[model samples]
Target: MHIVICSSIDFTPQIAQVAQGLTRLGHTVDIPLTSQQIIAGELTLEDYFAEKTNAGESARRKIEHDVIRSYFEKIKMADGILVLNFDKKGIANYIGGNTFLEMGFAHVLNKRIILYRPVPEMLYTDELLAFNPEVIDEDLALIR
Candidate 1:
């Protein structure tokens, strides 16, 4: 199965561990961003002044919207989604964050949902955690 590993880029080690487990079980995994990108400059917010100096605020907003839309299109292509654990900052406050939206989209589509965190603490709430969760099982049959 082609798995969409949805999680904050900061948790690369955790994602890699889960991905490795999935790979051993014959699944392909794809994560959105790298740990370096998250640490250096994850596009959490925009600077209107910077855009105003060049392409103007309107163009900047459009670009942001387009980028997010493109990402969702990519998520739609995945066979399943693996939601990781929230960091200390908490994923809840990051509502505009792409991870949350991708997870939500996957849920609505009724695709295979895999939760591969150390603990069951949720960033969204109880409603989001109602879906079936995947545990590490080497003998689990492949969906593909």
Candidate 2:
């Protein structure tokens, strides 16, 4: 199946690994530009976050809008979304704001939602549970 890998920029390495595994499994995979940039050594996660933080409000808004719009288009083209929900800030199976938004976009598009790990206790736990994403538990083959 064609799958788009979504995760925080902080997890780009892991996302890249997952993408490689999925590709080896004969699945088509797409990753966000942030991950691509990081993987290509064009920017570090710290630099990316710093750039966003240092940008003016209007510039930040435009950047965010463009990135999200691009991802929405990607989701529309994909068969499903595989979320790399690694633990963050002591929250196991943590899904951050942007990743959660991507999940919502996939859910609305009726694309299958797959999680690298099971949904964990979180602020929006109920909402995430409602989407009923398939938990692969680190196994890329489970995406099907």
Candidate 3:
């Protein structure tokens, strides 16, 4: 199955590993450009975030908006979305705003929603429960 790996920029290394694992399992995987760049060492989290900081709020917002739109396009083309929900700020299975938006896009597109981890008791717990995402833990084969 064609799958798009979705996660925050902070998880780029993990995203690359997950993408590789999915590819090894014979699934086509799509990752964000920022993640790819980070994996290639063409970009770093420090530099990426610094660029956003230097660009100022308005320009940064535009860049983020464009990136989210691009992700929506990828989600529309994919068979499913594999969320790499690692812990953040003490929240296990954390799903940040961007990942949540990607999930919404995939859910609305009728694409499969696969979570690499269980749903966390976060602010969006109710909304995430409503989506009924497939919690795969480490068994990525369940992504199909």
Candidate 4:
């Protein structure tokens, strides 16, 4: 199966590990562009986010638009998405705003939605559960 991983860019290392595991399983994996760039040292996570955080509204809009579109295209090309949900901000299996949006896209695209952990406890947890993502509980083999 071909899988596109969806997660916070902060989890680049863990995403790489998951991607490798999926690759070993004979599955083609595509990670978040930022994750790939960060792992490759082509991009610095802090600076990228810092710029976005401090940018003017228009600039931030443009940045977000470009990024969201790029990833949307990637998700459309893949067979499914592997959500690399990890603990963040004291929330176990955290799915932040962006990861949630990506999953929403995958769900709309009729792609398989696999979660590395159970649905998280967040404001949008109900909406996330509505997507019906398959929880694999960190078992890469269970992704498919």
Candidate 5:
């Protein structure tokens, strides 16, 4: 299966590990760029901070628009989506924006929706359950 692994850019390591696992399972994976990544090739973190400190609101908005446009491009290429809610920070939070946007796009495109949060404790939370009550054990089977 072709899968698009989606999660926040700030959580790159977790997303990379999940992507590797999915690839090993014979699935093609496309990972989305993180927010910081738009300028990563051109600017260091310090440079971004410096720029943000000096740039006008209009410039920041333009940067955000570009990042969002790049995100849409990735969505167009995905077949199925995998939401990585497995957190490296030890804080049990829902999977981030990339995954949610992917989910919305997959829904519109009639693609498979596979929400995989590896932390079992977090999985049973009201937050996730509420976000997607239709998800059942059959979906969970895909992770293995």
Candidate 6:
């Protein structure tokens, strides 16, 4: 299976580990672009998120760089998307705005939705459940 990983950039390191597991299982994996850059030492986490400090600048950056659209393209070509939903901001199994959007894209595209953890308690919990994601609970063997 060809898989695209969706998660907060904070999980960059863990994403690499997950990619390795998927590879071991004979699956082709693609990590988030930002995470790849950070892991490659070409970009820093802080720098990638710096524009987020200003709402206007963030919006501009997203538009100018085609961030969302590019990810949508990746999702469109993938067989499935694996969400690495680790805890963040005191929320267990956190799924931030971008990851949520990516999940929605995969669902509408009829792509498999895999979650590394259980559904999180958030404003979008109901919507997340609506996606009917398959939870792996950190077991890569269960990816199918």
**Which candidate wins on TM-score?**
6
Clashing pairs in 5: 9-34
Model 3 C-alpha lDDT per residue in residues 1-144, reported as the tens digit of each score: 999998877888889888988999999999987877778898777887777567585356548658888889999999999999999878888898888999999888899999999998987899998888999987877765
Model 2: ten consecutive residues of lowest lDDT: 53-62
Regions more than 4 Å wrong, model 3: 49-65
Expressed as tens digits, the lDDT of each residue in 1-144 for candidate 2 is 999998987888898998999999999999988788788998787787677678584357448759888999999999999999999889998898889999999999999999999998998999999998889888776666
Error of 3 at 2 (Å): 0.6
Select the stronger candidate by lDDT from 1 and 3: 3
lDDT of each: 0.58, 0.88, 0.86, 0.86, 0.58, 0.91
Every model's Cα RMSD, please? Answer: 6.9, 2.2, 2.2, 2.4, 5.8, 1.6
In candidate 5, which residue ranges exceed 4 Å CA deviation? 35-65, 87-91, 118-144
Q: What is the TM-score of each candidate against the true structure?
A: 0.57, 0.90, 0.89, 0.88, 0.58, 0.91
- Please give, for residues 95-124, the per-residue lDDT of candidate 1 as tens digits: 224566776778777777765443344555
Comparison by lDDT, 5 against 6, better one = 6
Arrange candidates by lDDT, descending.
6, 2, 4, 3, 1, 5
Count clashing pairs, candidate 3: 0
Scored by lDDT, the top model is 6
Choose 1 or 6, whichever is better by TM-score: 6
Which pairs clash inside model 2? none
Residues 1-144, model 4: lDDT tens digits: 989999987788899998899999999988876777778998787766776578584356448658788889989999999998999889999998888899999999999999999998899999999999999988887765
Error of 2 at 134 (Å): 0.8
lDDT of 6 by residue, 1-144 (tens): 999999988898899899998999999998877788788998887876786686787577568878899999999999999999999999999999999999999999999999999999999999999999999899999976
Candidate 5 TM-score, C-alpha based? 0.58
